[model samples]
Target: MAVAIRLRQEGSKGRLFYRVVAADQRFKRDGRFIEILGTYDPQKKGENTNIDIEKVNSWISKGAQPSETVRSLIKRQVKAQASN
Candidate 1:
Protein backbone atom coordinates (compact mmCIF):
# COMPACT_ATOMS: atom_id res chain seq x y z
CA MET A 1 0.00 0.00 0.00
CA ALA A 2 1.26 3.45 -0.88
CA VAL A 3 1.28 5.65 2.19
CA ALA A 4 1.12 9.41 2.11
CA ILE A 5 1.27 12.29 4.56
CA ARG A 6 -1.10 15.00 3.45
CA LEU A 7 -3.71 17.56 4.42
CA ARG A 8 -7.37 16.88 5.12
CA GLN A 9 -9.66 19.83 4.64
CA GLU A 10 -12.47 20.71 7.03
CA GLY A 11 -14.60 23.69 8.15
CA SER A 12 -17.15 25.74 6.22
CA LYS A 13 -17.13 26.76 2.56
CA GLY A 14 -15.56 30.20 2.82
CA ARG A 15 -13.53 29.41 5.91
CA LEU A 16 -11.13 26.49 5.91
CA PHE A 17 -9.21 24.46 8.46
CA TYR A 18 -6.80 21.60 7.78
CA ARG A 19 -5.64 18.48 9.52
CA VAL A 20 -2.30 16.93 8.70
CA VAL A 21 -2.78 13.20 8.37
CA ALA A 22 -1.14 9.95 7.37
CA ALA A 23 -3.23 7.98 4.89
CA ASP A 24 -3.19 5.70 1.89
CA GLN A 25 -2.32 7.42 -1.35
CA ARG A 26 -5.44 6.10 -3.07
CA PHE A 27 -7.88 7.55 -0.51
CA LYS A 28 -9.85 10.67 -1.21
CA ARG A 29 -8.60 13.97 0.16
CA ASP A 30 -10.77 13.84 3.28
CA GLY A 31 -11.22 10.09 3.46
CA ARG A 32 -10.02 7.60 6.07
CA PHE A 33 -6.61 8.31 7.53
CA ILE A 34 -4.16 6.28 9.56
CA GLU A 35 -3.39 9.05 12.07
CA ILE A 36 -3.77 12.73 12.75
CA LEU A 37 -0.41 14.40 13.03
CA GLY A 38 -1.55 17.97 13.68
CA THR A 39 -3.38 21.01 12.27
CA TYR A 40 -2.97 24.05 10.07
CA ASP A 41 -5.12 27.15 10.13
CA PRO A 42 -4.20 29.42 7.25
CA GLN A 43 -6.56 32.11 8.46
CA LYS A 44 -4.56 32.61 11.60
CA LYS A 45 -1.81 35.20 11.74
CA GLY A 46 1.30 33.70 13.39
CA GLU A 47 1.97 30.14 14.51
CA ASN A 48 -0.95 28.92 12.43
CA THR A 49 0.75 25.56 12.06
CA ASN A 50 0.80 23.05 14.89
CA ILE A 51 2.53 19.79 14.00
CA ASP A 52 4.26 16.97 15.85
CA ILE A 53 7.74 16.85 14.40
CA GLU A 54 8.51 13.51 16.00
CA LYS A 55 5.46 11.90 14.44
CA VAL A 56 6.21 13.45 11.07
CA ASN A 57 9.77 12.22 11.14
CA SER A 58 8.64 8.72 12.03
CA TRP A 59 6.16 8.64 9.17
CA ILE A 60 8.74 9.95 6.75
CA SER A 61 11.24 7.36 7.82
CA LYS A 62 8.54 4.76 7.20
CA GLY A 63 8.27 6.04 3.59
CA ALA A 64 5.24 8.28 3.71
CA GLN A 65 5.55 11.10 1.21
CA PRO A 66 4.21 14.53 2.13
CA SER A 67 2.42 16.85 -0.23
CA GLU A 68 4.22 19.92 -1.55
CA THR A 69 2.53 22.34 0.80
CA VAL A 70 2.88 20.04 3.78
CA ARG A 71 6.58 19.63 3.01
CA SER A 72 7.14 23.38 3.14
CA LEU A 73 5.10 23.71 6.33
CA ILE A 74 7.16 21.03 8.02
CA LYS A 75 10.41 22.71 7.01
CA ARG A 76 9.24 26.09 8.29
CA GLN A 77 7.99 24.68 11.56
CA VAL A 78 11.20 22.75 12.17
CA LYS A 79 13.32 25.81 11.44
CA ALA A 80 11.25 27.97 13.79
CA GLN A 81 11.46 25.43 16.56
CA ALA A 82 15.22 25.12 16.14
CA SER A 83 15.70 28.86 16.47
CA ASN A 84 13.92 28.92 19.81
Candidate 2:
Protein backbone atom coordinates (compact mmCIF):
# COMPACT_ATOMS: atom_id res chain seq x y z
CA MET A 1 0.00 0.00 0.00
CA ALA A 2 1.15 3.51 -0.79
CA VAL A 3 1.46 5.44 2.42
CA ALA A 4 0.64 9.13 2.51
CA ILE A 5 1.00 11.93 4.99
CA ARG A 6 -1.80 14.48 4.71
CA LEU A 7 -4.47 16.56 6.45
CA ARG A 8 -7.89 15.74 7.85
CA GLN A 9 -10.36 18.57 8.30
CA GLU A 10 -12.02 19.35 11.60
CA GLY A 11 -13.97 22.03 13.53
CA SER A 12 -17.16 23.82 12.59
CA LYS A 13 -18.17 25.66 9.51
CA GLY A 14 -16.32 28.97 8.94
CA ARG A 15 -13.72 27.82 11.46
CA LEU A 16 -11.31 25.07 10.49
CA PHE A 17 -8.69 22.88 12.09
CA TYR A 18 -6.66 20.05 10.65
CA ARG A 19 -4.64 17.11 11.79
CA VAL A 20 -1.61 15.91 9.88
CA VAL A 21 -1.90 12.17 9.49
CA ALA A 22 -0.26 9.14 7.95
CA ALA A 23 -2.56 6.77 6.10
CA ASP A 24 -3.08 4.50 3.13
CA GLN A 25 -3.25 6.35 -0.18
CA ARG A 26 -6.52 4.65 -1.16
CA PHE A 27 -8.31 5.97 1.90
CA LYS A 28 -10.64 8.90 1.64
CA ARG A 29 -9.46 12.36 2.68
CA ASP A 30 -10.99 12.14 6.14
CA GLY A 31 -10.96 8.37 6.43
CA ARG A 32 -9.03 6.32 8.97
CA PHE A 33 -5.42 7.33 9.53
CA ILE A 34 -2.58 5.11 10.60
CA GLU A 35 -0.98 7.75 12.73
CA ILE A 36 -1.43 11.38 13.66
CA LEU A 37 1.96 12.97 13.25
CA GLY A 38 0.79 16.42 14.30
CA THR A 39 -1.69 19.20 13.75
CA TYR A 40 -2.15 22.55 11.99
CA ASP A 41 -4.28 25.15 13.68
CA PRO A 42 -4.41 28.33 11.66
CA GLN A 43 -6.05 30.11 14.55
CA LYS A 44 -3.00 29.64 16.70
CA LYS A 45 0.03 31.92 16.99
CA GLY A 46 3.42 31.24 15.43
CA GLU A 47 4.97 27.88 16.32
CA ASN A 48 2.03 27.17 18.57
CA THR A 49 0.67 24.78 15.99
CA ASN A 50 3.06 22.17 17.24
CA ILE A 51 3.97 19.62 14.64
CA ASP A 52 5.99 16.56 15.52
CA ILE A 53 8.79 17.48 13.14
CA GLU A 54 10.82 14.45 14.11
CA LYS A 55 7.89 12.14 13.37
CA VAL A 56 7.20 13.79 10.04
CA ASN A 57 10.83 13.49 9.09
CA SER A 58 10.83 9.91 10.22
CA TRP A 59 7.84 9.08 8.01
CA ILE A 60 9.42 10.83 5.05
CA SER A 61 12.64 8.97 5.66
CA LYS A 62 10.66 5.73 5.58
CA GLY A 63 9.42 6.59 2.07
CA ALA A 64 5.90 7.70 2.93
CA GLN A 65 4.50 10.06 0.32
CA PRO A 66 2.82 13.38 1.00
CA SER A 67 -0.20 14.69 -0.84
CA GLU A 68 0.03 17.84 -2.97
CA THR A 69 -1.18 20.12 -0.22
CA VAL A 70 1.20 18.54 2.23
CA ARG A 71 3.97 18.94 -0.33
CA SER A 72 3.18 22.66 -0.52
CA LEU A 73 3.32 22.88 3.26
CA ILE A 74 6.65 21.11 3.17
CA LYS A 75 7.92 23.59 0.60
CA ARG A 76 6.82 26.45 2.78
CA GLN A 77 8.51 24.82 5.73
CA VAL A 78 11.74 24.55 3.75
CA LYS A 79 11.51 28.21 2.78
CA ALA A 80 10.94 29.17 6.39
CA GLN A 81 13.93 27.17 7.49
CA ALA A 82 16.09 28.71 4.76
CA SER A 83 15.09 32.22 5.82
CA ASN A 84 15.94 31.50 9.43
Candidate 3:
Protein backbone atom coordinates (compact mmCIF):
# COMPACT_ATOMS: atom_id res chain seq x y z
CA MET A 1 0.00 0.00 0.00
CA ALA A 2 1.15 3.50 -0.75
CA VAL A 3 1.35 5.34 2.54
CA ALA A 4 0.34 8.96 2.76
CA ILE A 5 1.24 11.40 5.47
CA ARG A 6 -1.93 13.39 6.12
CA LEU A 7 -4.24 15.06 8.62
CA ARG A 8 -7.23 13.84 10.59
CA GLN A 9 -9.78 16.26 12.00
CA GLU A 10 -10.66 16.24 15.64
CA GLY A 11 -11.93 18.53 18.43
CA SER A 12 -15.32 20.27 18.23
CA LYS A 13 -17.21 21.09 15.07
CA GLY A 14 -16.44 24.80 15.02
CA ARG A 15 -12.97 24.48 16.48
CA LEU A 16 -10.90 21.82 14.82
CA PHE A 17 -7.65 20.28 15.97
CA TYR A 18 -5.71 18.05 13.59
CA ARG A 19 -3.64 14.97 14.06
CA VAL A 20 -0.88 14.47 11.56
CA VAL A 21 -0.71 10.83 10.66
CA ALA A 22 0.59 8.24 8.24
CA ALA A 23 -2.14 6.21 6.60
CA ASP A 24 -3.07 4.20 3.57
CA GLN A 25 -4.10 6.39 0.65
CA ARG A 26 -7.41 4.52 0.39
CA PHE A 27 -8.42 5.20 3.97
CA LYS A 28 -10.88 7.91 4.80
CA ARG A 29 -9.44 11.17 6.15
CA ASP A 30 -10.41 10.45 9.75
CA GLY A 31 -10.23 6.69 9.45
CA ARG A 32 -7.59 4.26 10.60
CA PHE A 33 -4.00 5.43 10.64
CA ILE A 34 -0.61 3.85 10.91
CA GLU A 35 1.06 6.45 13.06
CA ILE A 36 0.34 9.69 14.85
CA LEU A 37 3.38 11.70 13.92
CA GLY A 38 2.26 14.96 15.50
CA THR A 39 -0.37 17.69 15.77
CA TYR A 40 -1.33 21.05 14.29
CA ASP A 41 -3.16 23.74 16.19
CA PRO A 42 -3.84 26.69 13.94
CA GLN A 43 -5.56 28.55 16.75
CA LYS A 44 -2.33 28.94 18.64
CA LYS A 45 -0.57 32.27 18.52
CA GLY A 46 2.80 30.96 17.37
CA GLU A 47 4.49 27.65 16.76
CA ASN A 48 1.06 26.22 16.19
CA THR A 49 2.64 23.13 14.66
CA ASN A 50 4.11 20.31 16.68
CA ILE A 51 5.80 17.56 14.71
CA ASP A 52 8.66 15.14 15.03
CA ILE A 53 10.72 16.00 12.01
CA GLU A 54 12.98 13.04 12.49
CA LYS A 55 9.97 10.77 12.37
CA VAL A 56 8.52 12.59 9.39
CA ASN A 57 11.75 12.38 7.50
CA SER A 58 12.18 8.79 8.49
CA TRP A 59 8.75 7.95 7.10
CA ILE A 60 9.43 9.86 3.93
CA SER A 61 12.73 8.12 3.49
CA LYS A 62 10.83 4.87 3.71
CA GLY A 63 8.66 5.93 0.75
CA ALA A 64 5.73 7.61 2.40
CA GLN A 65 4.24 10.39 0.32
CA PRO A 66 2.86 13.42 2.08
CA SER A 67 -0.36 15.06 1.03
CA GLU A 68 -0.30 18.58 -0.36
CA THR A 69 -1.22 20.25 2.92
CA VAL A 70 1.01 17.93 4.88
CA ARG A 71 3.87 18.62 2.52
CA SER A 72 3.38 22.35 3.07
CA LEU A 73 3.41 21.86 6.80
CA ILE A 74 6.55 19.80 6.53
CA LYS A 75 8.19 22.56 4.53
CA ARG A 76 7.28 25.09 7.18
CA GLN A 77 8.64 22.81 9.83
CA VAL A 78 11.88 22.42 7.95
CA LYS A 79 12.21 26.18 7.49
CA ALA A 80 11.43 26.83 11.14
CA GLN A 81 14.03 24.34 12.22
CA ALA A 82 16.62 25.85 9.91
CA SER A 83 15.97 29.30 11.37
CA ASN A 84 16.44 28.05 14.89
Leading candidate by lDDT: 1
Off by over 4 Å in 3: none
Put the candidates in TM-score order, highest first.
1, 3, 2
Query: Model 3: clashing residue pairs?
Result: none
Better-scoring candidate (lDDT), 1 or 2: 1
RMSD values, in order shown? 0.6, 2.5, 0.9
Please list all clashing residue pairs in model 1, or write none if there are none.
none
lDDT of 3 at 83: 100
What's the lDDT of the predicted structure labeled candidate 3?
Answer: 0.93
Q: TM-scores, in order shown?
A: 0.96, 0.76, 0.93
Off by over 4 Å in 2: 74-84
Decide which is better by TM-score, 1 or 2.
1
Backbone collision count in every prediction?
A: 0, 0, 0
lDDT (tens digit, per residue) of candidate 2 on 1-84: 789999999889888889889999899988998999777787877753445667888899989998787776666666666698
* Alpha-carbon lDDT, every model: 0.96, 0.81, 0.93
